[model samples]
Each structure stands twice: as C-alpha cells, then as structure tokens.
Target: MSRLRPEAGILPPVSSPIAQQASFGERLRALRQARKMTLQQASKETGVAQSTLSKMENNQLSPTFNLMQKLALGLGIDMPQLFAPVHEARISGRRSVTKKQQGREHLTATYEHELLATELDSKRMVPFKSRVRARHLDEFGGWVRHEGEELLLVLEGDVLVYTEEYEPLPLSEGDSTYFDSTMGHAVVSVSKDDALVLWVCVAQ
Candidate 1:
C-alpha cells in the first residue's frame, strides 16, 4: 500500500473495505468532474501544483495532510468525503451499523485506523479505532494537527501521548484524554504490543 505523507499517514490498501467502494483517485476524479473542473482549475483552487493534482487523479500520488485539507477546502467538502462516498442528500434519523472489523480501514506507518459509521454524510463527529504502531517520536515527521477537538480512549495496552504544548502523558486501558485537535499531537504505544484506542474527532 502506498503511504500518505509522514505527518498524517493513512492509505486505504486494495484489500481494505473502503477501497471496495472507490479508490481515492476515482473519487477525486468524480468530484472534479461533477464540479466541471479542469485540472488547471483544481490546481488553482487547491494551491497545489498542477502536476501533483494530475498524479493524484491518476492514482500515482498519495496526498499529505496539508494537501488533503487544501483539497477539502477547495472542493467544498469535508475531509472524510475524500475517503468515503457521500450520500446524495442529508436526511433526519440517519444511522449506520458497522460489524466487527468491518469498518473502512486506512493504514499508516504510525497507526492502523478503522473508520466507523462511514455510510452517513455530513457528520459532526468522525469516529475511528486506531492501533498505535509508533514506538518513538522520531517515527513522525511532525505532529498531526487538524480542526476541532478530539477524544481518545485507550482500549488495550498503554500509550504515551505527546502534544506540542505539554509534557507526554501516559494512558492505560480504559483511560482517555480529550484535547484540542489543533494543538498538534501524536501517540505511541508503550506496552508490550501495539495499543488500541477509540478516537473521536469533532468536526467543525
């Protein structure tokens, strides 16, 4: 699987459930075509090089966190829409059920993420399960920062959370931490095995 940029690594491999619905390149192409946008127009709107956008649309390039944010903002859609297909319209009383190990998987060097409830569109909260794979800070190029607040609950083993503005905090199974997602943060497993956590990010 091709990995995303080091700062916010995540890529849906061919075997991942999310890839079954649509590849990132296919989704990008669809969105651009739906908007009647040419590659030049998309590049201008996204502040990305035209060649880069072309490569992305052709599945020859994986986006970084910064690129994803720019694409979302430029395309007038939320970040999750980059990975999951969106419903045609929003409606009331909507719900989606995900069976065990059935959530859309996005793998990264530092974390293996399973995005939950991806069938719904325009969600206020994005929930996912992550397996902490990094054991050291150097594994990440920089902190992963984004809009909104985040809640992380340790599911198994132990983790050490690092934030740009605070000392490292250790968390055990059943423990959790909530913080501003904009502060820049990363988590590493400190246990014998990789740790698991339920992470919920409140979108703005």
Candidate 2:
C-alpha cells in the first residue's frame, strides 16, 4: 500500500474491491506504456515531476486528486479511465456496498479520499468519503477547480468552505452544500480535530 508524506498522514490499508483486484500504480503504468510514452514524456506533458511519476508508478506514493487529474489529462483520457482496469468491461446495473474503512484510499495534502463505486465504468459521478486535514486556507497552495458539479455533506466536526466568488462559509455536522465544480473552491477543517464529509462530484 502506498502512502503520502508525514504531514498528509498515512493512508488506511485499502479493503475496497478495486484495490483487491488492482492498484493505482499498476493501472497508471499500464496506461503509460500502452501509449508508448516514457516517464520523461509524461512528466513534461503533465507538469508533474518525473520522480513523483516514478513513485506513483512504483506504488511508493499515493497521488492526490489534483495530481491524478493532471495525469489523466496528460494521458489524453478522462479521470474515470484512470480507475478502470484494462480488459475489464463495464458491468451494467452495478451495485456496490462500501463499508466503513473499506474503500480505495488516496491521501492528499488537504484531504484523504476514499474513492467509492469503482465497479462501474463510464459513470457520470464519482463519490468519496473524505477526511479534511488542512485547518487553514494557506495550507492549500491554490484553488481547486474542475469540470462538473460537486456536493459536500459534512458528517463530523466543523468545516469552512472557501469559494472564489463568496466569503468563507462555515458548516457544521449534518450540513451540506452543492456548488459548481468549475468554481474555485477549497474546504478546510475548522474543528478542534478532524472533519469528515461525503463528497460526490460528477464526471467531466
């Protein structure tokens, strides 16, 4: 199991169905090789360091959502394609049940993402149960804007949502907000400890 840096915290051991079958690094490597591209080429195109790309391919690093999105764009594919294992066809009417502590994990500087519903490909939305880590806006290097819409439902503690067009908004447990993903936004924990949220974003 790969992990992020110390400040970002360690990723939970994955118990998700997807992780049991394949790894993010393995899939990423396969995609890279399939296009006859080298790590240097990918790094140049994606603006990600070659060492980081190598670590990701070697399963020594866990990529952030933004990093994964950049890799997808560099590979000339959509984000969903990165999660899909080659030669595995999409199963229609797919149903999945992810128990607590049982989803594929990806740790980032700001949040820990547990990706859910990986069994189905060509999905319109991707859901994650995330743990907010960063306590201040300065912790995030910049705004995060992506294609689609996103909904965040706070499950624990307090969180502050910062948007490009609006002032910082505070949310408590059981509060939820839906916003355009294209808008620059970031969420930070305001609680004394950690905060949890169920985030669902539509596919680009």
Candidate 3:
C-alpha cells in the first residue's frame, strides 16, 4: 500500500476531569509520592511537562498513548504495569489463553483494547487487540511517540498509519507494520468498514 502525507500537529482529544480521576491517576500519584519526588523532579526525569504531570496527578487531564509509555519509563515499570489494576509478582512458566470475550477490555479515546496475558507478571511484552476509532491525524490530536518497538497487524479493515519521519502508510486487512515506538505515530481507519488490529509492544 502507498503512503500519504498529512498536515502537521495532530493531537488526541481531552478526557473529562471526572473520567480522568480514575485509578490511573491515583496510581500515578502514588508512585511519585512513594519515590518522594516532586512533580517538577519527576517531569525532568520523564521528559513530560511539569504542568502536564500536575494535571495527570490531580486527575485534571488524561494521558495519550505515548505519554503513558513515557510515564512507564519514568516510573521504572513496564507499560502493562501502568495498565494493571494490581501488581502480581512474576511467576515462572505461567501460561494463559483467552477466548474472544474473555480478556480484560477497556476503551480509551482512540481505541478499544483487550489486554492479553493479564495473568502473567513482569512480562517482556504487552499484547492486545484494538479497534481503531480515529479516521485521521486530526482525530489523533497529534503524533504519538514512546519508547520501545511495536508491531501492529490489521485484523479487519484498511488502516492508515502516520509517523513523524514517514508519510502515512495504508494497510489493508492482514497487512502489518513494525517500527520503533519512539517515533511519533498514530493510526486511523481509512476504509468505510470498521478496523481491528493486533498490537504488541516490547517492555523497555
């Protein structure tokens, strides 16, 4: 599939304060306090703006996918740890399989994700199935950049991927893309049909 260029400076939509005040905010604040680090100090370490950190801690703002990845690095934890409701000590030889309706599913602004292998702890990778919702870079708010690498496979319909360094790439069902997550990126459904994708990210 050919790639297309998009207009610059797209960002994600903001979440309501009430919705932002969920367990994620509490947990993020708790993690910072536990380290006795002020938001300013943490921001320096994480490369996130101090004001943004404050908003996140106070549940006044919600993070983007790349921001979450940055927070995970700042907290010295994997991305899945940020998503986990409770921590579980890593156990060896753990195995799990989930049916179509069995995995833990949640909706963010950009996608509906079903987390895979939640039973395991300290995993080297996080795997999930996501339904793409946004149809353009404008809907994404902005390009997304994080750490590590990611693999995205189109499961249902055609998808268009945008990155900072590359033109938008279009993929039909069964096509896949693998790249460094640190490069700013976003995905949209370009076809009239719905889009489902399998996304996997390695732990940093």
Candidate 4:
C-alpha cells in the first residue's frame, strides 16, 4: 500500500493525560472492512465464535495474545496487523504514557518491547512494545534493519522517526503512523519524558 503524504506544518505531537483511549479496537474494525470480510467469515475461518468476533470489533473485549493470533491468521494478516499504525491527522509531537506487560525476550535496554507473538520471526510480522528514554538515540543504534514496513502507535512522549524521503514522523498519544525501513530509519525520543510506543515491523 502507498503511504499518505504528511500534511503541511508538522502537526504538534499529540499529548494525552489518559491512556487506553487509543483506537486499537477501531483499527481492527477498519482492517476488517477494508478487506471486505464479514464477522461470520472471519469466525468460521478461525474456528472462533461469531459473537466473540463481534465483541472484539465493538471494542468490548480485550484480546489475549493467543486469541489475537487466531484473528490475524483468519484475516490473512500477521499477528502484528491487529495493532499496526494508521496514518493520523498530521501532527508534530504527541504525548501519552502506557505501561505494558510484555514478553521478556523482546525487551531491549534502550527499548523495552513485549513480544506479542513469536510468529513474527517466521510470519514476517514482529510486534513489540517500544519504550524509549529521552536523549536515547544511540540506544537504538544496535538496531539493524532487516526487511519490511514498520508501524508505530505512540503510547506516550514524542518519537522522531527519521527516514530518507521525508522528515521525522513525530507521534504522540492516540496517534499512529507507518514507514518503510529499507531507506534506513531510526526512532528518537526528543521529549523530556519517556517515549513509549507499540511497533509492528513487517517484512513482506
């Protein structure tokens, strides 16, 4: 899919005092509609109940990691797609902090990320919770871009994501964005507070 161009005058990064207002549930619904699939079709494919799917789409249910896998597989997407970033109203900086409980393995010193699903290694979709401290550019220095597109949901603070084509995508709480890492990109938190984000890197 092609990317939408960033709007003029970088949007001031979003700042939110409250968390859990993100559209995680709405994104799932958007994907389902975009694919022209019905709830029954997905439920049948995943062997899950139709009512369960409804609750999920309605944002009434918080899905477990295992259940997330089933939904992603049924939708012909990798597990990370469920939380993939969506282009938002262009904004420069956004702020919101979220503390997540993730798997221990994917956590890095500079960036603490919980692995949503191990299938990322093979499925080419790696989902992680990224926590970046201020002035922590070099912390991500160890990162090596392998392949795929990266999506981020800014949980808190400001992240300056630099790529080749355009300037950094500064995202904040409730904001989301996507980028291809082939051109070499890095995420830096310019905010005084810690920058927390959810990243889904997909290699297609």
Candidate 5:
C-alpha cells in the first residue's frame, strides 16, 4: 500500500518491528511529483533511470542500498533519517542533550569530536577536535568549512594556519586566534612534533 503524508513524501517500506516497511521507491516517486518534478527530472538529479525508479516504486524491483542512498540524497534526507523507525518519527522536542552526553559521529581521524550537527534540529555552535600525530605531521591538505566564523586554539603542540593572502601564522600551545572563515585557509604542523587544536565554529 502507498501512504503519503501531506508534507512528507516517503512511506514506511514494510511493517516490520525493526525495519520500517516503507517503500523508498514509492516515496521517491511521490516526493518527486510533489516537488512538481518528472521522472526524467529525478533521474537527472539522482543519476537513476526513470524506468528503474518506476519499477522500484511499483514494488516490481527492490531498491539496493546504493539506490536508496542516491534517492535519500536527492530528497535531501539523511540516509539513516530516511529509514528511521515509524514509532520514532521525529526526535525533536522529545529529548535533550546532557552535559555528559553529546550526539556525535566519528570518522577516521586522530581524535574524538562532536561532528557536524543535525541541520534544522541542531544547536547554533559545533565543536571539533583535531589531534596531532605523534609519529609525524598530518599530510596537510586544508581546513574544512561549512558555514561559520571559527576560533581555533592550539590545545597542544604547535600549529600553523595559513590564509591565501597572508603567510602561515604559527601558534604555540595555549595560543588562540579568531578569524573570518570565508577565505581559503589551511592548517599544518609548525614543528616536527605533534599539533592538536580545538575548533569551535558558530553556525550562521
């Protein structure tokens, strides 16, 4: 059965106790149509075929993980949020983050951090910790940006951050700086030793 919320386009795939039996395909089709988009339009945006999407929506074909990922991204939904349980539809106004417990997502890096926050359901400020390497310096690439002004503090060791115009500024442990993040900026290790810093970015 196809179910559509007035504003929500997706449905529970199946009525399983754990997994929602909602149809990603049907939701995709309905969402596309609701957005005044054609199958061809969705295909252009998601790189999935119109026929494939049609088949999946009609339950003739089951969407693979990759297909659902593409569909979720096209629909502007987080992968996990899209497949969230029916019983727990929206987590908003339900719980609060405690001081000892902050929601976090971690990736392959040197240390721990409270990663990017949920967009609309998130707090204003986001914090991330960059830990230095003990063996050698990080293969310096550049600073990652989202939307914010950042104040970076050298929590430990030495750090050098450079903007496109000015030369790299070296800051020792306990030193800190605040700057506009619109410009192209990158961070590197100033010393042959490690460099760890705490970054607090305020959302706009």
Candidate 6:
C-alpha cells in the first residue's frame, strides 16, 4: 500500500453522512428510482428473487455480502454506491483520504469490510480492509464470484484462500495474492484470531 502525506493538498477527506444515516433499503430504493427500475426488473438483473428485492426495499430483509455484490453488479454500480450517494460528473485529479479504521463498514457473516474511498463515485477500483471471520469453507453460503480482478494482502494473522479451481492456499501477515474475480473464491481465518487483509478489486 502506498502512503499518502497528510500535508498534501491533493488528497481530500471523504465522508458519507447520507450513507451513515440511511438504511440500505432507503438507499436501494433511491438507486432504483433514479434509474427507473422496477423490483421485477431489479430481480431479473440481480438474479435475486422479486420477493427478496421487495423485502429488502421495505427494510424487511437484509442482504448478505454475496447478495450485495450481485445487487451492485446488476445495478451497474459499485458496492459503495449502494450505500452512498452517486456523483455522475467526471473530474480530473480526484483523490480521497480515509484515516485508519475510518472507512464505511459493511458487515457479513464471513467478513467485516471497511469500504475505503466510498465517497467517490465511478471509481475504477474498490479498496477495502476486511477481517476474515469464517473458520471453515462451509460458513459461506456459496463461492463468491464477480466481475473484474482482485488483489488481497494479508495484514494480520493467517488466512486460507479457497477458490473454485485451486487448492486452498494459506497466507500469513504481509503475504499477498492477485487473482481473477470471475473465479469463485472465499477466505477464512486459519489463526485463532481473525485475520485482517487489504482487498482491492478492479471495477469491470
């Protein structure tokens, strides 16, 4: 990871107050409305059931990380955009700074994610810090697959990376790997303590 100098005026602090205040249901509805998409349409696009989408939009249901990923991909938006407001204008020299442990959090059964640079829309890459909480492959509902490429760097403890096409690989702190995002994959902590990792995914 490259360190940015705080004194550099080129980097601006990014905050998502709207995301922090609104429920996922509200945000989802807003996005759908903005795009003039119906729940049935969203269901078809996301591969999620219409009843599930309706329940989610009504705050009667909460989506898992995998489901959220599907939603983001179907909506043609980044995962962070599902939580924050979208800015459509294109700008040059854009940069954001997220202080330690200050990124927007998105929790799941197997991983706790701190989504970084979330205030910026139309990002080419999505960066986050995550804690591996699952201890076994069975903890995940299924393998996670999505568009683009991914890079994972272990920050603390140990983890086992499992992919559809390869044997599980163990990684320790400071170890990193890059792989195609389209391949189904999941990660679990192998250490007593949950492992932490920096994950960056290229937007496809």
Best by lDDT: 1
User: In angstroms, what RMSD does candidate 2 have relative to the true structure?
Assistant: 5.9
By summed lDDT, the worst window of 10 consecutive residues in model 1 runs over 1-10
Per-model tally of clashing residue pairs: 0, 0, 6, 13, 7, 0
Where in model 2 is the C-alpha error above 4 Å? Answer: 1-23, 40-55, 58-62, 73-87
> How accurate locally, in lDDT, is each candidate?
0.80, 0.76, 0.72, 0.58, 0.53, 0.79
The digit string of per-residue lDDT tens for model 2 on 1-204 reads 122221312233447544565577788899999999899998998878899888777766766666766787788765656766533556666676778887766667688777786555556677889999989887875677766788999999999998887888899999999998877788999999989999988746
Against the correct fold, how does model 6 do in TM-score?
0.83
Tens-place lDDT per residue, model 4, 1-204, is 123231111111124211133444576788778888788877788766888777666655555433565677677765655664433344545333334463422223345446565323234556677777535444443333434577888888877876657766777687888876555555778888778888777655
C-alpha-based local distance difference test score of model 2: 0.76
From the highest lDDT down, the ranking of the candidates is: 1, 6, 2, 3, 4, 5
Q: Which runs of model 5 end up more than 4 angstroms from their true locations?
A: 1-105, 108-121, 133-143
Model 3, range 16-70, lDDT digits (tens) per residue? 4424424556768887887888998899888889988877776556566667767
Per-residue error for 188 in candidate 1, Å, reads 0.6
For residues 1-204, write the lDDT of model 5, one tens digit per residue: 122111111222355321243444555566677668788888888777888877766655544334544775575554333332223245656543334324332222323333333332333454556654423223322233333478889987887776655667878989998877655555666667657777776644
Prediction 3 TM-score vs. true: 0.77
Please give, for residues 1-204, the per-residue lDDT of candidate 1 as tens digits.
122233644455657665665688888889888899999999999887898888777765666545766788788887678778877887888888989888877666688878898877667887889999999988986778766798999999999999878889999999999999878788999998999999988856
lDDT of 6 by residue, 86-202 (tens): 878778999899999888776666787788998998788889999899999877766777678999999999999988778899999999999998777889999999999999988
TM-scores for every predicted model: 0.83, 0.75, 0.77, 0.45, 0.44, 0.83
**Model 1 local distance difference test score:** 0.80
